[model samples]
Target: MMALFRNLFAAALFVGILAAFEPLNYKDCKSTFKINSVKADGCPQENGKCVFKQSTFKINSVRADGCPQENGKCVFKRGTNPTIKISFIPDRDLPKLKASVRSKISGGSTFTTFSLNNDNACEHGIECPLKAGQTYEYTQSVEIVNTYPVVDDVQVNWVLSDEDDSNKKEICIVFLAKITE
Candidate 1:
């Protein structure tokens, strides 16, 4: 009888330790915005000052970093429900394109397999948003993939027409990356 109780206590203790070490869910995101502008003959001058034209872009689809730590492994949730979103609004008037974005992407850093679509507003397609305005969103489908967590970063580029010249602007959308089981 005493041995049976001891075995049960030991098993409980082992389970408790395992539970304490379980992976946790952690999320973080950062957004950087930039604008590119060009004028026809030259920037529009107001009061003899130059006013540059602009086209701005929005970044979206933020993911989390998959690193092992105290809070993360502890609070890690089971499924992917709430994904991070990124947004942008041009300070001026012009056309904007979302070229490309990478998340926890590796040498196979290709997101072509993901469900990416065009935003109603512009021509660029890489990191295009679901809406035409500035706000855009991409969701991380956490499921069997969480078996091995990872940290990810989302980078994007947009093209701006400066007069007859075409220029590109860059932006970064960072997230809390996690790859775990």
Candidate 2:
């Protein structure tokens, strides 16, 4: 009997240790953004100006490190991998998602664009057939593939829509970003 109790205790301790190292749930996490090894508040700005934006979805937490945030926004570099994390609630079923990004130089006429489609939310690691009124954190990595002489601003947009009707967007999120180099 004593050996049985000891074995159970060991197993319980092992489980506890594993759970302690698990990544925090989206709601409970309070992570910060890092740019070039520096902590940032949001995306970067240009000429002391940053056009910050968000969406109707409830964002519990956000972090965009590769794209450092400054002056209440974030900044990205050309030919770099910029990552973004957002925890939000759809508030309705969303079978698919449409995401697009475009950038216009701060003082130039150059532009850069990238578009993606998530036919099945789960295929992209997002819960598909998303339950209405449930919150989920989405982390996406965007590669800046433009070689424009200048990339001043970026507009990140996402549309959550039903599978049957692409024209009907249940939710929309548009965020602006500043770029350098």
Candidate 3:
């Protein structure tokens, strides 16, 4: 009985570690950005495809500081700012870039757009005229205003598009988050 208990405990520990490092599920919107593969930390890939979800634009990783996971979703408190860190590699040279965020409440057909204080990527950490085949990291703190409805299972989409042509996207990522009081 002692050996059986020890084995079970070890297996459970291993499983928990795997779950904690699971990659963010995302979908790459079809656009001008071209890359061979996008890789995230601890995220596994098979046959040139991400195992978690079907995505062409893979980011290194996305971290939301001050947001805690509750019941498998990141909980964001109202009227607070959460810092987001993203690591990615641009496949093409981009002179100017703009960033935007939108959210879709669970069971809602339309997505509500959120305003950012500074939408310019250059104002953030990124230098203008981004080079191809080079990696870049962007950090920004987004405000979760009080006006937002407190809800669960909200689908948030973050996009980086070319300033000259909004249709040309440099990066597009989606993740699940929840808003709470």
**Top TM-score hit:** 3
Task: For residues 58-112, write the lDDT of model 2, one tens digit per residue.
Answer: 4454444465544433566777766554555665666655444455545547645
Arranged by TM-score, best first: 3, 2, 1
RMSD of each: 18.4, 10.0, 10.2
Regions of candidate 2 where Cα sits further than 4 Å from its true position: 1-56, 104-112, 117-121
List the pairs of residues colliding in candidate 3: none
lDDT of 3 by residue, 1-181 (tens): 9999999999999887435333333444553443223223333322232211222234555545545655555667898876665566676777888888888998999998888999997787777787876766665667899988899889777777779987665676666678998
What TM-score does candidate 3 reach? 0.70
Return the lDDT, model 2, position 167.
55
Of candidates 2 and 1, the better by TM-score: 2
What's the best-to-worst order under lDDT? 3, 2, 1
Better of 1 and 2 by lDDT: 2
How do all models score by TM-score?
A: 0.29, 0.56, 0.70
Better of 2 and 3 by lDDT: 3
Backbone steric clashes in candidate 1, count: 31
Cα misplacement distance, residue 21 of candidate 2 (Å):
17
Cα displacement (angstroms), candidate 1, residue 154, comes to 10
